[model samples]
Target: MKILIIEDEIALQQSIAESLEKENFLVETAADYHSAVEKVFVYQYDCILLDIMLPKGSGLDILEELKKVGKAENVIIISAKDSLDDKLKGLELGADDYLTKPFHLAELNARVKAVLRRKNQQGKNTIELRNTVLDLNERQFFVNDKNIPLNRKEFDILNYFLLNKKRLVTKTGLAEHVWGDNSDQADNLDFVYYQIKNLRKKLQEAQAEIEIESTYGIGYKLIEK
Candidate 1:
């Protein structure tokens, strides 16, 4: 899964990013309000860890902006403030959950998993569709009950496809989601094509019931056979 950490505390932000990355999640961060706004506007994330206190603005404003723009990325508010009004306000602004700071990292990880399960994975650790299984916790993929070895990029591509199944996923969208914002600087989408090709081959070899169909001149779609 992809996560954005919007925090002003550099140490806390980096620590959270490292921990999430260790769990095989793609993580990006912003230390202030403006950068956070820019990221949310440009890229997509499975979830966001929003800190209420920031350098330029309140995280409440960020949540409000997300609501205004109709962006539905699951948000979990992380703040040092423990006031009931702050918590209620954050929830009212559409944050999926709230995590009080000075908490355990393990607890935070569990909360993130819970939110992702509720918001993105249909409240399950494994995403099962069309004879394929993606085990989010294990970072493993299976087809017909057989394990399929996949490189990191291939797994990320497959995960993205499963999330958007049947919807047209533009190459640019895929790149930004899986490869992060740096993909915006790439000269061509050949890398995305290559990853998809490899992922398709693996799935076919395993006799998986899903196919990544090219949209031609546009993007690709995941279709169940």
Candidate 2:
């Protein structure tokens, strides 16, 4: 899943991003309200970890703006404020969960997973499609009950396609989602092609009925027969 963290604490933000990245999530950050607003407006995220207290503006405003745009992006408020009023107001403004400051990173990670599970996985950890089964926690794929080994990039590529199944995903979108900021300096998308090819080969070898369609000059689509 893709996540946007709107926190003014640089150290904490970096820590959160790193932790989520290690968990195979596409993560981005915004230190203030304007950047957060811009990100939420332009890009789509499965969830947002927003700090109630920011430098330029309150994170509550960002939540309000998301609601105004009719964007149903799941939001979790993270702040030092432990007041019941703040929690109630944030929940009223559509926050999914609240995390107070000085909390454990592991606890924060758990909360994020809980919110995403409710939002996308319907509270399940495994994602099953066609003959393929993906273990979200283990980051493993199985076909016909046989485990398939996949490199990190290949696994992430497959996960991305599964997440957006039957949708046209551009090369740019794939790069951004998988490689993130580093993709900006990439001159060619041959790496993406290579990774997709590897993933497709593995799925085919396993007799999985899923296929990825290359959209010529565009991108790819995961099609399941």
Candidate 3:
């Protein structure tokens, strides 16, 4: 999953990003309000970790922007303020959960997963399409109740495809989703092709009901076989 961390505190921001990355989450950061607004408008994320106080603007306004466009789904507000009004107001504006500052990274991670489950996965840990099941918690894939082993990148790529089934997924988007910002430094995305090839072979060998169709010069689309 991808997460946006909107925080002005440099140390805390880096800490949060590192912790989330260890959990295999593609994380992006916005140190100030302007940057945060830009990312929120430009990309889609599984969840957003929002800080109430920003450098130039209140984070509440960001939430308002999200709600206005109906892209507001999984948002967990993290702030230093513990006022009841802030908590109530944030929830009223559609935040999934609120965490006060001085929180453990483990707790934040747990909250992010919970929100992704409740909002994106419909309160379930697994996402099912036809006979294929991807377990979000266990990080496992199953076909016809048989577990299919997958490497880390393979699992991330497959998870990205399943999340965007049948949609036009560009190679750039796939790279960013699986490898985060570091993918931009790669000399080429030839590695992506090889990984998908391996994943496809495994699925075919297992007689999976889904196929990842190529879009020629574009990327791929996961469809029913």
lDDT of 1 by residue, 1-225 (tens): 899999888998889988889989999999999999999989999899998888989989989889988774589888873455776788888887776666556556656775676685466778889799998788899998999999998987887678667767767667755775457579999999999999999999999999999988878989999
**Residue 81 displacement in candidate 1 (angstroms):** 3.6
Among these predicted structures, which one has the highest lDDT?
3
TM-score of each: 0.54, 0.54, 0.54
Quote the positional error of residue 207 for candidate 2 in Å.
0.7
**lDDT values for all models:** 0.82, 0.81, 0.84
**Model 3: residues >4 Å from true position, as ranges?**
123-225
User: In angstroms, what RMSD does candidate 1 have relative to the true structure?
Assistant: 14.4
Worst 10 residues of 3 by lDDT: 175-184
| TM-score rank order | 3, 2, 1
> What digit string (tens of lDDT, one per residue) describes model 3 on residues 1-225?
889999999999999999999989999999999999999999999899998889999899999889999877799888864455776687898987777666667557756765675675556778898989999899999999999999999998888777667766767667754774466689999989999999999999999999999999978888998
162, model 2: CA deviation in Å?
0.8
Clashing pairs in 2: none
The global Cα lDDT (0 to 1) of model 1 is 0.82
- Give the range where candidate 1 is weakest over 10 consecutive residues by summed lDDT: 102-111
- TM-score-better candidate, 1 vs 2: 2
